[model samples]
Target chain A: MNLYEYEAKRIFEAGGIPVPPAVRITKPEELAKVHFGYPLTLKCQVMSGGRGKAGGIKFAKDLEEGKALAKDLLQLVIKGSKTESLLVEPMVSIAKELYLAVTLDRERGCPIFIASAEGGIEIESSHNVLTEPIPFPYHPYVGRNLAAKLGLKGAVMAKVADLANKLYKVFESKDLDLAEINPLVITKGDDVLALDGKIIINDDSIGRQPAFKGWMEAHLVDMSPRERRAKMTDLNLVELDGNIGILCNGAGLTMATMDMVKAFGGQPGNFLDAGGGSDQKKTLAALELVNENPAVDVILLNILGGITACDEVAGALVEFMKKYPERQMVVRLRGNNQDVAEKMLAASGLKLYPDLEEAVKEAVSRSKNATKKPALAAKA
Target chain B: MILVDKHTKVVVQGATGKMGAAHTKRMLDYGTNIVAGVTPGKGGEKIHNVPVFDTVMEAVKTTGATCSVIFVPPYLALDAGYEALDAGISLLVLITEGIPPQDTAKLAAAVKAKGAKLIGPNCPGIITPGQSLIGILPGSIFKSGPVGMVSKSGTLTYEIALALTESGYGQSTCVGTGGDPIKGLDYQEVLSMFEHDPATEVIVMIGEIGGNAEEEAAAFIKKNVKKPVIGYIAGQTAPPGKRMGHAGAIISGGKGTAESKLEAFKANGVRVAMTPGEVAKQVAEAIKQPAKA
Candidate 1:
């Protein structure tokens, strides 16, 4: 779960990390009453990196330019990340820049703190760090020792150590995979401020972390009735940008299916998992999600059933197609009750393939034909 | 004989519960000598003709069950593991999830200190072919064969086993190490055992995205093991830094990505399959390939 920059900053602020005062404005009108001083930096907060390089940041000489940049950013979308709001802050002219971040080092099976004297573009230069891997799941003494090497001392050093310890606690406690601060700038007065923050919480630990639970509860957004039905069934349904909508069970299989589509020279628009088990209603809901995607030219059903019976899924697919006749369907069945499901699918005049390799090939070929059929027939 | 021998009677913690009851019936159905179950406040209750006790020690003493399978919740899973460890159980299999990372580190330490072999915390327990059906995988998918199977995903274990069985390959033992980020037995640990097992001709590994377990396993496979091992990593196109529903399916930084794992395996000259169905064929071919002169 990747939090937007502002949300991550809020978490950092709560942990006593200093950040320049900032506000998120969705519209130019919202910046009308803004009282922040000159030399303001307007940044469009998108999830992807390279924001500065992507022209997502602007330095406005005056309030009018700042407001105009904010409005322009609000109207633009960069790399599919919406610029719904701009993070406005008083720009700090830095004397020196240091970059530091804390993330789970999966290879060592522990958290890691990556730090370098270089900051900004140097930090983003791909290979900034020149230190050996530090053992995380750290000892408190270890934290203090690392802090000392950073020239941190006195109450301030202690404070940074305390912050590191607390950050470790939050990383472990909240099941966060990442807690980063890029270009942790040093002001002319030698104050450390986290200029940008990023965090990716462990989704598995969402069950254990109350903070994430509370965030979800507080920010539960509205959805359409169809989406509401899909949500009620514990299935996450999102439309994709391509015409091939996939319905797969396991995460690995979903990716494998998506790759197979790409391997067969087809584009996959979305990834949807119906989980391990699905009754008829959940299957129907999943199909509805696929049909709702306008970019979807054909829906692919790929499932390796263990606890879930393929027969039941096939039955659901047949039933769903009866009501939603506008979309084409391709079903691939394997595992339990696969034979019966294939028989049913065959009888329904729907395309069914046993092998994933062959199935993806046919699905890709068919979708192309479907796309070109109207054009060719209109010419005739 | 695998990690746990046939003579080792087993007790299941959280017995008479949903998962415990289901596994108890299945294990007993498979002729495993499950002697006791532990469920707090449900002592004296019997699940699948196995006696239930409130404490692990009581079950161990009364039923002589030296092995325990745990199906406790996240908060109590660590305690359940500790309880089994304290009871002097030589082998413990945990199938619970959502345990705090710190708690898992502590539990792993304790298990090591007790010299007890732990299987999983979020895994689908372990199984000995034709001996015991101790885990949650459906029994119909497995048959006694010479191949040893170990995996991180529960669903993929069944899929791989089914493929092997269909290909006239039977598993000597199959284990799902679970997908929890902090788990007990990893791929390398399981691979080491498979290398020593005489009955095991080939080891089939199914790994998923997330941590560097696959990369570490590949290194171990390259350096130490002489046996032919074929593997298929799940989440080929998984986005970096995104968790793939499974607790352990997180691609942190640049590590744990399929591309990195693939590169490691390729660099090591390990035979890798593009799909789960390809695992059996590759393993069969690798087993027949003569060692480099």
Candidate 2:
């Protein structure tokens, strides 16, 4: 749900906030058409933070230098997220940098703005910040008070407050989880411009946020193939580097399964939530996704049938496990229609374990045995 | 116990749906006095022998139902919640998941404005063991005891409750705050309720990583809660920024980390349990020794 800087700036611009003149380009060859003057700023459009410090951003003095920098920025990778596009901007001469962000504070039970005169990542350690809890029917005075609290006055204060208001309108209108205008710079020419920005759309609100109704799957970044496949299948999956594949009906159970795997001296290959109602096809798809990991020594399917019928999951297990008869599969089915599932699995010549601890213990040991050779885990 | 007890009349929203109808039968079979159900168009019908009404207002008015548990689809959860709240249902437990957080936020704000209490929109609802079963939880797994429970997860709550029942530790009430980012009630509020309830001798809070709810609960326990609060956080192995099944189970920006939550709980007066089994064991130890304030 994190938007790249280019996308965020687009929203910021529509919200009436001033952003430095910029042109977005996907290819280095497109840099020739951009009319931004010398000393251009080339920023990689990646979701990862600290891209600037990671050399994802560079300065270009001319068209020749811009092409070179554009090529480098587009090819750069920061924290495993590859750069696919670049935001080419004319580096503005600024007198000061300020930090301003609006985010939901779960502890406070409302959205609040965190503003500071000092901007950039250094604000993490800076203490000179003012936190203004957003009042309902947001007034201009709230932003003005915040600007004044930061020791601002006159036309500069008025402009900064206006920036805060516009930024907040975008935040509230978009149902954003976070809207940040980091380094809201005061230019040498007495203009306030957003040098950089970040916006994270709330995942749940994507359905209402018209711009991203189906945006997640379309612009998925830093996702493995299996992950993308799972997304397309409407399954919740997070791939892990482990030996045992874990599939469960709920997030809590899946995570607890992973924790128990670690506790029992085994590692879980992935965290997959097959969802509340797991029928035959969904179960089969989930099994296939979990089994996609070649290093996965064993697959454990845990279903506490609160909203799901165990028989469907059991049916899928019986069929999928039969295909790979040599592969190790463990299942713990309880709750609704569990008795039926138990009978179905019994008829298929598949064993079913009722106890979670017993099932997990057996699966861990079986996975350990599948590898055959145990190597010492090196301490980093 | 701050939960719907035996005498509380309850209505099931989306009563004609598969999940609602199923849980209604289960709850009725467990002896819960479900007064009525509301399914919009499915009026004058009966679900598990409970009268069905067209709307929440009519259901509340006709049956005198003061509490409602919803199983409607995620998108319509807000309207369902508002209907229940506007109809004078003081306690609204939403069983549906995947409602937009902004909608939940607005629902929560309205719930507060109306002076009503709301539970999960993505949760399993609430259960007062041996008293009332107004949720999707299997009634047999829980028993009447002194332990009170609050969780951010549905299945994990079931797993731990089963573990507790097997270990001879029955529960007073187990409430799911739902795993969504914005829920009606949280650990801090639920903890304070448990602390004041004489029936609830010990409180068990199951938290997920993502938000600062656990940290806030830790601070609350440090100051207000006197009961022994046992905490177990799921998703210890969850990587940063990856949503671990639950929307609220992600660790973002080094905050809401398992390590940070565990540390916060330990630094405060709360006893932390690493796993589900350990949580049950911790409650046993907590009961034996009077918790030090």
**Standalone chain B TM-score for every prediction:** 0.95, 0.98
Regions of candidate 2 where Cα sits further than 4 Å from its true position: A372-380, B41-49, B267-269, B285-293
Model 1's alpha-carbon lDDT is 0.73
The complex in candidate 2 yields a DockQ of 0.66
Per-residue CA lDDT of model 1 for A1-380, tens digit only, reads: 67778888888888777888987888777776567778888888776677888889898888788778887877666766666478888889786676666765434444577766576754545574633244433577655765676776676566556656656665665667777777777777767788888887754456777777755432223333444445456665543456688888765567677767876788886767776657677877787776666567778888777656788898898888677655677777787678888888786787777666677777787678766222111111
Give Cα distance to truth, residue A262, candidate 1, Å. Answer: 5.2
Candidate 2 lDDT over residue span B142-246, tens digit each: 998889999999889999999899899999899988888777987877888888888888889998888888888898899998889899989887889899998
Q: Which 10-residue window in model 2 chain B sums to the lowest lDDT?
A: B97-106
Cα displacement (Å) at residue B31, model 2 = 3.0
Tens-place lDDT per residue, model 2, A1-380, is 78889989999998999998889999888888778677788889898888878998888888888887787778888999988799999888988889999987666666789999998655567888888888665788988888899887788899999999888889989989999988999888778899999998986677777777777875678789899889878899999998889999989988988888888888889999987877889999999888768778888988888777788988888778676666678878898788888888886676778788788898999987885433322223
Query: What class would a CAPRI assessor give candidate 2's docking?
Result: medium
